[model samples]
Target chain A: MGVPFTPRANIIMTICLGTIACVVTSGCLLWFAWPYSDYERHVGWTVEQPVPFSHQHHVAGLGLDCRFCHSSVERSAQASLPPTFTCMTCHSQIWTNAAVLAAVRDSLLRNTPMTWQRVTNVPDYVYFNHSIHVVKGVGCESCHGNIAAMPLTYKAKTLTMQFCVNCHRDPGPNLRPAENIFDTDWHRGPDTPGPAALMALYHLGRRNLTECSICHR
Target chain B: MRCAWPLHVLPGALLLLAAGCDDMSKQHKENPYASPRSAPADVAQGSVEYHDTFHPAPGLTPALLQRGRSEYQAFCAPCHARTGQGDGMVVQRGFPAPLPLATAPTRSATPEQLYAIITSGQGVMYGFAQRIMPDDRWAIVAYLYALRRSQQATLADMTPAQRAIQP
Candidate 1:
């Protein structure tokens, strides 16, 4: 026999090693990025509900306040969903015969609760409180997006650990004045207080908002 | 045998990675409204069990009035206009208009009676006893008094300080 190996074998070996390296590198990148993607986070996805309630019509068209139905937002951890009675408060008279409101009317008549699908949520391990955020002047639009504009309510934010930590690290820029906390369309105006002033106003100084127990426990 | 050690480590590495996978997102703990039957059961009409008479009205303070104003805006302003004209946005959208707060019957009604109407259904309006807390209901009553006074006030009703600021 000649030699056990040919000169061409070195070139073939190099090619195989290069291909493997490329595949492993790309696979690592994709694995790390998968959780952060909006697709994986279910952002902008509308959940199917018993009744397709329109936030746009009730919030924008009718000019109803968010607290009108979510009455416990400023007082409780969960911004409680409205009972069937809340729907009947208006539907009993205005949309009494509409086909879409049949489920609502039936719920009231049967004394069953209308099951509303939760559109936005964090993981069970995360203890997020709506009252604390609202009390601290975090605008509803900050996490919920332009709620008055969504015809069918959808998850507007990623609600991932990175998303929560980003705000927790620097909360001033996300805060609003007490009066503007509920205004979904509010933006920082020339007269609006700067982040530092708002930080002082809300008494956010000296507190470790990013402490592990602050959100995790 | 030395090369086989890498193969042995592979299984251990895989087990380490698998340890990270868990059902933490959907833990066994109960969250708010998690159950289909989370809502409170409806009380029958004219049920004496629904009486809130034990929870007396809180004393009037500026803070109480402020809380009342916000609570009223949230709970009452949908059907009863902010100005107590009974032509709120919900009314404009075809819900039956409530009687104006400045009207004879409402204006002459005592605070306790107003509280009762809010606590229980009055005519077409549904009772808000389940939604509004007792303290907040009292606050709303106080705010309604302020709204009525504001709507019915004459120029003579203004104090010197208020009159001076008037255009």
Candidate 2:
């Protein structure tokens, strides 16, 4: 294509600049204003940490369990933040050399809990139940993603309302056996019931879906 | 100019169309207090329970009673006064008086009645249900009973354990 003869280049240029500015600003808005994580809080906003822990070390290399620390995911409302005792279970032998592990030990000895800045937090008014999701066959990765690979975990997925409803509406890809839900290798099994089968099942109550009250209350 | 028409017009048209198709249910993904119609409790179904007058627990132990008293002193004393005459420092200084529940009539009173009042609020006294959990509200009720009983127990019949707790 060749440049048009300059009959109206200024209007074209002004509109072009305005559109570029709008595009840039909207992109920023989506990054800053969009809430991520289970808490619906922004993911990149900084939070203080008491101990620098690595999931890559514990989850991937050492083959520890997510439920080992996030013990309440299969049980309660709050994923009961692990007590200092949960940490001492491993660090008692493993990495006592690290100053942060020493602080964990100190907090345990004094009967105080570490004020670990929570990642993947949700808003206060929103109630989430890991037990229901875990029991009902939602994979841990559906929200937390492949945490076994993340050393310092950032919010793995944007936990927007649409993200939740999209899955709720059509959860075929996200479902797995309740047992293997936490196992990262778990996937659509051999006979593989995908979204169409799941969509059909949704009508028959094989979906086991609930109304707002299950979470709201 | 070439970018302007598509930039303002195209995205706006797309977003409006997308939001309409999204999650048509009134399902609140983020509301914690969203009604639990999904798993409606057998008891909490359409019935609203009332807890108007504060009632004392009948067979509460002294230790439990004392614990309740301490909790009341911390939580309730701000409004209901140390003596439960509805004249705590809040009211003496500025706030509205809490209803005197001890003498509130029986046709109007029961543990359930008290529980309702605590949960739902009456006239000037706001319900404490959401402020405290179910177990804690029960604990406060038990203490209120102890408070009423203490007013009735003679100095002669009081146990040494009870006597030790004067304040």
Candidate 3:
């Protein structure tokens, strides 16, 4: 080399390169750790279903109630899937000849149930009751996101433990009147009671709201 | 000089990882939940083949009537009140009031005539033909009759059990 590099200069250059590497690596690690960066919560991710059911069409266009198909949401643990008969209620007359509805027809004729792919799931250790949440002033959109706008249903929320804990910690911002429980697009207005008041109004201020047994058991 | 291996491999590895994470099965666009375009009506009223020939479908069992009532509550109750009074929430929200089904002239109409009215839009009311099945339509007719009967029932019409529970 022309004029061999001094040992001090070489040491300084190595330190500078090492510092850049440390900063770049830490920055990347921070970005990846963000909860929203998880691919599952992002758009363009959809589960393949036997029948492509568009929530946007039924809920938005037709204005069908969430309870029309998910009947048990008001009183049961599971948001029950619509039975084959429910599909036949409309399909039996309309689109009877459409090729796309062949699966619906086959299931009816064969007396077999159509198994819709479950989009959102929770760990077995966690107990989530739909009826309790629905009756207690939680809106359908609170946890499910903008379901009426989804052309194809996808898991909107990450449903991470932190997500659940955040809501359980303070539910006022998410609470609505009993009448508006089904209104997904509900927004708190200037005159509306704040979350703290709603929590008190709904009797949801119980200290054990975050206890393990409240959900686990 | 820095080795060129990492420069070539790093981006390629990241791209491969991204590609690997993508699911290929969700590409189909056929969505049955979307309301398909209704077929164009070929023939109009007054044609020889277009005579008012719709009849009340038979097999009006108790179960069917029950199912009809439930279905009516789900589908019809939004515009037509559960009591058939035409004072549903939609009307309260400024929609023009529909004729009450419990009215004398409406209650007197035959089920077939009612079915025709339901299948075809009359005045401001749109047709429910694409939404309700023929069987369920008849079931709705049965339920309508039940609603009319309940509204017009006299004390004499009450059974002993009903009389006992009347209070």
Candidate 4:
């Protein structure tokens, strides 16, 4: 009877501990889950645009060059979006009445440019140039994956800093001949030189590709 | 008194954290080209050449043909070689080559016929009608004519400096 504390005190303490345990368990789960989530990387997630332009059909089926639409890729920092007039050139002749192309037709009618949503994006702080990478013999498929096979166009690789570091540390595997830059299915053949030889050919010496100034302005 | 404050703060912290879980599913905007505002003028559009309804433009000038050459390289060089020999990289890969634009029959083709072929394709060649504007088609046709003419040029066609450079 000398004990001042009752059984109710023990019950309260157990409940508080149980709640704390539950919270800690869920916190760990969420921490691991966020990176593995589908939305974080946007892999396999197709963005709906004014026109559901299929890179698969055009690049693979039709066999058109990437520069046909991304005209400034070779000369500029941006692989710029094709102007409305480029779409109108073909739309005005065929599929002129398709409901799906109504936005495209409306742009031509209203004289407005069509806006395409960007699929793969790096942070604004990071400065990436398309022309330099292209001139240096990096194939489109290196960063873009097998774009010819992508029917709906999604972010194939996570644009994380770690991902960038992995490539910058060693760009040999991603290197190809300048002539074969547009060849999506190109791979090193048995007769072809090794990655070291290719690196030598492209003049990619043992320089640090992952320097802070390399990407960060 | 046994950490009553921690219990009170825990649920509130959890509620705040749950609220911060952003929904990135709707990141992309719908109706990409639905904007009705007047489109910004394109610099390349200024180079386009449209054949008038009644009168064809006079003999192709060097400037006009140069614009045509660039336009052709951008749009036609993939399927039609820069030489207009229908030996583009796409054809070299395995695509069935279209008839060379510098052939005798192609040379005989009227500007309108060449425009139609570009707009409505032929054989296995798919139409670029939607992608290439009418004015650019005329530009390509003019360049094609120039290419054919250059193929048959004689020493008389060259200037003194050009003749000196000729092999």
All models: lDDT?
0.86, 0.61, 0.73, 0.73
Better of 2 and 3 by lDDT: 3
lDDT, residue A4, candidate 1 = 79
* lDDT (Cα, tens digit) per residue for candidate 4, span B9-124: 99999999999897543344432233434323333432333552533544567877876776687688766788888887666756667787777677788888888877766665
Give the alpha carbon lDDT tens digit for every residue of A1-217 in model 3.
5868988999999999999999999888877666445474553467787688888877776566786677668777877677666665456545678787888788777666676766776655677899899878889888888888999998878777788889888888889876567766778778777778878888888776888888876
Put the candidates in DockQ order, highest first.
Answer: 1, 4, 3, 2
Best by TM-score: 1
User: Where does candidate 3 clash, by residue pair?
Assistant: none
Which candidate gets the maximum DockQ versus the true structure?
1
lDDT string for model 1 (B84-109, tens) is: 88999999989888889889798899
Per residue, candidate 1 scores C-alpha lDDT tens digits across A1-217 of: 7987787997899999999999999999999999788999889999898888899998898878898888779888988898877777777889789999899888888888777778898889999999999999899899999999999999898988888889999999999988788887889999999999999999996799889999988
Report the TM-score measured on chain A for model 1: 0.95
User: Each prediction's DockQ?
Assistant: 0.53, 0.01, 0.04, 0.12
Which tens-of-lDDT digit does each residue in A76-178 have in candidate 4?
Answer: 7877677776665445555667898898888767666777777877666677889888877788888788889888888877767777888788888888876
Q: Write candidate 2's Cα lDDT for B64-160 as tens digits.
A: 6665565576456755767777776546544556576466652247767666666665665544543344555667677777677666678887788
- Per-residue lDDT tens digits for candidate 3, residues B1-167, read 78789898999999998988854334344322322222112222224343445554979799889867866876677667888999766565455777898995677899888877766656656555544556777888889999988998999998888889946
Candidate No. with top lDDT? 1
For each candidate, give its TM-score against the true structure: 0.89, 0.45, 0.56, 0.60
Lowest lDDT 10-residue stretch of candidate 3 chain A: A35-44
Candidate 4 chain A TM is: 0.82
Alpha-carbon RMSD to native, per candidate? 3.2, 20.6, 13.5, 10.2
